[model samples]
Target: RAFARSEVWDLLESCHLRCNPLGDAGVAELARGRQRRFLRHLDIAHSDVTDDGLTELSKSDRFPGLQSLEVGYGYSVRSPNAGPAFGPDGIAALLTTEQWALKRLHVSVVSDTPLAGRFEELRSRFADRLTIQQIGTDPHR
Candidate 1:
């Protein structure tokens, strides 16, 4: 992939692939690319990256300096269904990992899912560093 041999990999600081629909396979490729030591921000909202992709990203040692990550659609007035492909399990995997130096994260989830129950706990753990938006309709409603 281009990212793997990019000459600017060491100098690149931010990457925004919003709405690209790269999915899990694409994310895996990006994760396996050459180390991005200076990269700080990554926005993959609406890229179709699922929990498996998030897990791979979190486990990669290439992004040691990464500080901010935006994985989901938060308050975007785009397509109603165009949110993150991941859920509570993805977030848990990201936060539990010790590889990243993340200081900020943004994500969106449906209100009716099990993520709602763990939202408070996750918020408490990360405090203001984590921003989560509950989007979509509540299935019960």
Candidate 2:
């Protein structure tokens, strides 16, 4: 609320909302206001965002400078259903859009799930700009 009304939004270039409990509604709210003009990077990992939210974000033409977006459930002991609701459909929404200026996208999904395999297929389609990885575990670790 305060953020949407603040004048400081004009100066913000990168926003990291990781670990916040903001759901689809929050994403809608954040997508509003004038900050989109300057926001370049957005990280919503572990924020409970969903496909509907991603679609809404993609449909908006407000963000012309948004270059990077990170949406995933990072390392945690969450229940099978507790991670982010991201999937291939959401990725398609983001990629097919001509509204945003997205250049790089990173998504995390659970291993062995149908979503992971779908994402793999999507990865090859947008290999230059998209990166998909398994959630709760990192190959580097």
For each candidate in turn, the TM-score is 0.77, 0.81
RMSD of 1: 4.3
Worst 10 residues of 2 by lDDT: 74-83
lDDT of 1 by residue, 1-141 (tens): 676557766788998888786788888887888888888998887677888988988788877888888877332355555544676777777787887535588885544444556767887888767888766565566
Off-target runs (Cα >4 Å) in candidate 1 are 73-84, 109-115, 135-141
* Colliding residue pairs in candidate 2: none
Instruction: Name the lDDT value of residue 141 in candidate 2.
Output: 44
| Model 2 lDDT, full chain set | 0.74
lDDT of 2 by residue, 1-141 (tens): 566556776768998888887888887777775556788888887787888888887777666888888887543465654544767888888877877434688886654444656677878988988988774343654
lDDT at 80, model 1? 52
lDDT (0 to 1) per candidate: 0.74, 0.74
